[model samples]
Target chain A: MNPLRWLVGRFPTLALARRNLSRATLRSALAITAVVIGVVAIGAIGTGGEAFKQDQLEAYEGFGGTATVEPDVQFEDGNLTNTELSDGDIDRIRQAAGSATVLPVHEPAGSFVQTQSGTLLFRARVKGLENPGEFYEARNGTMPDNWRRTIVIGARIADQNDLEPGDRLRVNVTDEFDRSFEIAAVLKPQGFSAPLGADRTVFVPASEFESGGYEQAIVRVDTTTGSVDAATQAIEREFNAREQLVRVEQVQEQREQFTEFFGTVNQFLIGVGAISLLVAAVTIANTMLMAAIERESEIGVLRAYGYPKRAVVSLLVAESTILGVVGAAIGAPLALGIGMAINQLLLGDPFAFTAAGLRYVGIGVGFGVVTALVAGLYPAWKAANKRPVEALD
Target chain B: MAPEPNEDDGRWQEAGDHATSETIPTDAIIRGTDVVKEYETGGQIVRALKGVDFGIAPADFVAVVGPSGSGKSTLLNLLGLLDVATSGDVRLRGRDVSTFTDRERTRKRKETIGFVFQSFYLIPTLTALENVEMPRMLDRTPTKTRQRARQLLERVGLGDRLDHYPDELSGGQKQRVAIARSLINDPDIVLADEPTGNLDRDTGDRILELFDELRRDENVAVVTVTHDDYVAEAADRVVTLIDGRIRETESRRANFEEGPDP
Candidate 1:
């Protein structure tokens, strides 16, 4: 007899087994539901972690945004402790790489500002007097061309002091340098900062700085440049040719550091997902074992009818696989939706579903199938080895 | 006894008279010589079959009658290939089945010997007709198994009970379904272990009549294990077993006139 035909002929028997499973509908549903929860947990964790990592990578890669430039020097102990960039060197850089924005800037060493209502201590960052209006324009107020008599504080400080764009405040640079100035504007808080103490930044015109030269140059590009890498390379080449006594840092580096940090977190999440899938495998095996024990006599009857050992094993594994498939069919889409929801929550807005990060879905399905297959082995074996006489008795 | 012809030891014999034939061959539908079967339970050996010898031929209806634990059921099991003999040879169609492996024995049982159990071991999930078709499902017969099974059911006076499950059938109807199942493979011999044991006397007599009709028409050898004298009387020949050995074989003619003697 054709083995395939025999198997096909046994469909009624398999249907009988299926019917038996449905006999205790509630128990069967509960068992399958446990498997479903395990499947969903596995898929969601896996895909969710991958989506988060992808989003973080995009943010770090800047998603085709502007290249950044800042000082490479570190300042310490109130002295010109780091490499100083001369105004002439800044001029040479601005002329050499016009593609990059070179904002010749200075920060007042550091100081405290006290309004009549409350005292706010702040570090003063200065934009160049040449085009301070171009870069330092605030959301609430305009930057003053002559910034000696006008200054803008960060949004938080302005809010705390109840100051507006036209409000006048006593700005104490120091006891000898205390001068009353109009609050020209308050700039919006630009999120968290790395160097710390950024919330207390006070913007002033660079020309008012008492230092002989500027500390560093802040450069912003039009983002429509040839490429960020190309622009950075061009600026580096120009600075090297002149052998200028200045160092340039791309803001993209800070973004890259953030990406790397979150990438590790993504790895941890993937590990967590893998562990959940492993646990799901155990749950499936345990449930199948119980099912096999309950139906031992039925299996014996099939054997008496001349069903081969392979047939018994195949039937059992097929049942487990069917359960796994059902669970995954429900779980895969659920995980995708939940993962997207979580991403939206974290980003404060919904993100597009990107097809590039689809490995997570594959991982989920593959894990479910492989885990279910592994779980089926022992139960199938037990079913196959059961003696027909013993089971019937 | 009249000078009986030295007939072919295994050939089919006609009813009412042991009219042996030269053209036909039997080669012993079932022949057991000095078969002994024992079991060990809690360190005590229980001998189920002790030095028993029996011979049955094609178309010969032999009833093995014995009390409980007299090894009648054990002899039927051995003959039906459902169990093996501990010692001695059980030759069916000239082949000693004692050395056959389980798979070989299953194949032999399916193809050459049919079994009707005392409990009417019908597949509960299947209807009467489907249960009849089961043995055919195992066979590689070219005939449409379901059609053949339906004919067998109708033949056993269960034409209308084809779709009725075993649970829905009466005790007698269930045995009729089992009989149909046994004949599905067209086996040369049928081994019935107390087939009517679970039915009432009236129903059991009807079932025995059905078996007798089938044996006469199909010319298939029947070896039934029964403790009931009425059941044994229906057979063409009766073999009484006491203490796990055949005590005597009485001819149907003599049994018809004398009834059963203890």
Candidate 2:
């Protein structure tokens, strides 16, 4: 018979498979649970990884422009000792990338501020910028108009220190210098960005940087002039001519690197999950073989009743496929639940349902069913190849 | 008896008062000629059936009796199309089935023959009605098969136990379900291989009576392989086999009128 007609003729076999699998509920359940674990692993990891990548991309995009020029720091045993960027380096970068906006920043290391009541002291990251308005918006007060002993704290730091506009805060720089600065403003909260510490940062005027020159320069490329890559290359060339040790990092490049790294990690996780599925496949095959052995007499009886070899094979394959489908039906939703749980508990974001994640669910299910079918092939063949007389005997 | 017919040419006519006319009838359900079956085990060739010639007509209840190794089951398997002979031809309705392909043999088996095993091989998971409907379902007959299955179960006095699985049924009830399943497709021949081997004497007798009724009512050829003398005594004809060859054939004038000699 043709394949379509053959499939149509297998209704009774499918029904018989259902009955048989139900009869051995514990064994079948264990097999299905194995499939469920494999599917959930693949799906949960896939969705979680994609959601994290998306979050990273959004955070990078929120940091303003794509490119940044920073000093190549000298590290001794993985601890940063000093930076090499100077004001001359920033000027040369601005000259070479004429169409780009350069915002010079001075970051004082190991600095903190205290509330006027002396109730709290936070170890803070002090960001001294020439144009702070370009990066932060006011949450409670206006930005400082004069370069003096005035400060703007991030929303979280402001809330923690209980200092709003016009509040005097004692600033301790490097555990030695102590100065009192008026809280000029509080900036709105921006989530984690690698280039800028937004939520916990304390911003001050660049003129207050008493120790050194600019530490880093943020370069915003005018898209109408050239591509971001072109501007980055121009700035890198200018820095390269001035100093041997300089690192020009772009937000887009960092995003791509993060994506590539996570993609590899996701692939490794999927491979591990596939190993579990391989174990599941072996379990299914072993179970089917045992079942075929136990049901030899029944198979003989069926053959005596004129069920062809193909029908017998179809019945077995249908049974395993049903197990796979049922397991996937349970596991797919379980994976989504796991993804959501990870989002809520670990990443602290709502569950993201991307098209790629949904497609991975589909892949997971298809993998399960196809694994079952492939694993069932040998057992089905063994069942079908039994001679009726011998099996009856 | 008359020298085993040369070709099983489908021209044999019953010679009793049940014969309606002098002309031959085309109802020669099973015909085996010079059938030989061999088995090889542990580097030894054991001949199961040497050269057996057998045939059964419609409405005939023939009992095959033999010792343990007399190849009675082998002959039954050959006639039922469950196994092919190593040599010779077994025909169904005058067609040589030895040359049939696997698909053709399966088709013919489903349409023409039914088998009843000693163990009452009912699928343990299925209800009695479902077991009986197995053959019809295998044939892919869509509708009316279930009704026919129910009717057959009722005919076998299992109407009330139709919904019960094999485990829920008694030994006799399971056997009755098997018999009902055998007749669900209305096959031309019913091959019973020691159908009462596992039953008690009274239950065996009742099963024999049921077989007799089926033979009389449906005009089906019932060929049973049995060691029980009572079963042999109840048949219209008895064929005795010894060491893979038939030794004697006895025709009884009255069915079950004279039981086996004590």
Candidate 3:
């Protein structure tokens, strides 16, 4: 015997319920299809959200241990006092941020850069850092340990000007400083989530500028050891001990904000999906009611043959539950297939799945069955409780 | 097993084994004492049965016969424990049925009485064998129920039609299936309402013969509420009702040991 038949045969109520559902194949199939659509809606959206989140988190990998500290402009008597972080502040930050690398930054006033060939002049960001090797990787040449008159330009800026190492470019800072410097290296392009717009910035030696105070400071640490968190807390404490002196923000916080925002969106979408499922529940209830009404005389005969009201109720509920189970069984896999396709298209890995994805699918299936049970209850009770004579007549 | 009495004697008698003993037998499977059944239709009290006395013993073939608007179906419902009497008590196996709780009454009805209706009432989704096994499905083991259902169908001479759906079977075959279903639980009494009313004369006669065989062989009391004169005449006793009261009770047999074979 088929396992389902064997199982149904083992229980009379299940056998009867199955037989009743099979009597109207189209209505049952339509009811089940409604449930399937509802399940797929919830599962696929949740799965797609998780995949997008995973993709973002992966993009944020390289910037995990980095944080930025800038002067928190203090407004007293309607005047800005603390506009930039001073050297004393940098020393205090280094002292507080234990075991984390700190680099003070300078912004030079350079309008545009003309290549050594003098072919074209384009605007570019001018950043002065003491050691470019600590923060950036060289794609074409090398970043030196000892910094002098050498410069590193972002790959985009180098490509735009057709510049390479050993080539010299003039910095248009002021009329007094019109000297050209040798190109040390061309820096690789930073990822989308990388801070500082590193892909388009021009890097020069900090010693070349007579800096009094810096605009920003970069803090780098090993994130796995809780060093990033420790450094952020220490820097915040040191700068804002009495009053706000500087603002400290970690790159991971932005990623977390994105995650939280998507979490809310996912829940809202699931709620919408749940509403569709409830609609399916209503359809299931109607189908069950129709079945009960159509089989009123049959139910009367069962009752007259000594079947209790509870037996009749259970039989009807069992049929509705069967409809839900079968629908969810099909819908879960279909949702999984869609999710995998989405993951493969978006993240290039079909198997890139998360617990949340599975959980959503599980929840969809669970709700499908629960809605069916809830839907069946009213019709089952009404049908079973009808007077035998009334039903028979 | 007790030997079946000779069933060929024709005599003017008072139905069942109690007639020879001169009083209603205390061992009667079911009894009604002035059972009065009423219905309130549109604020008017419509009495379906008015203080009628009736009883049936084991192995008795009793037919309730009456004209339309007489209380035959109402009394049948009360006797079958399918409904309650308005003012009197209907007893099952000498116990007052009104005193039993709802569940207990249902259980008693299930275990003690079988029913065969005019339309056969077979579930269309179920095969003939499944319909036969329906009553015993809950209380009996599946294997035991199936085995007995098979035996009953074979006894009813529809052994080859077990797997057929109700629609697939003819009117006579469906009635046979219903008869087999009625015996599946081995109830003490089988109450049939218009059992042969839907069948042709030839098929109805065969159904009557099947009822006779069931009553004699199974030792079950058969009470049939019907309008067919042939059914009334074939029964061992006939209870005729008029205007919600029992007008007369006629017997065709003196006791269980004497009756005519089909």
User: Residue-wise lDDT of candidate 3 within B162-208, one digit each (tens)?
Assistant: 89999999988998898888877677788898988889999988888
**Which is better, 1 or 2, measured by lDDT?**
2
In the order shown, the chain A TM-scores of the predictions are 0.66, 0.71, 0.67
Best by TM-score: 2
Comparing to the true complex, what docking class would candidate 1 get? incorrect
Instruction: Go through the candidates in order and give each one's C-alpha lDDT.
Output: 0.65, 0.78, 0.82
lDDT value for candidate 2?
0.78
lDDT (tens digit, per residue) of candidate 1 on A57-168: 5543432334433445655687544455677767776766666666665544545566656555443332333455655447688767655668776666676667788776
Return whichever of 1 and 2 wins on DockQ. Answer: 2
Quality class of the docking in candidate 2, CAPRI style: acceptable
Candidate 1, superposed: residue stretches over 4 Å from native? A1-17, A23-31, A57-97, A101-220, A234-298, A332-374, B1-26, B38-47, B59-74, B98-101, B117-125, B135-143, B165-172, B224-230, B236-262
Number of the top DockQ candidate: 3
Q: Evaluate residue B232 in candidate 2 and report its C-alpha lDDT on the 0 to 100 scale.
A: 81
- Could you tell me the lDDT of residue A156 within candidate 2? 78
Give all candidate RMSDs, comma-separated: 8.6, 7.2, 7.9
Tens-place lDDT digits, model 2, residues B13-42: 344534222122234566777889999999
Listed per prediction, chain B TM-scores read: 0.83, 0.85, 0.90
Chain B of candidate 1 achieves a TM-score of: 0.83
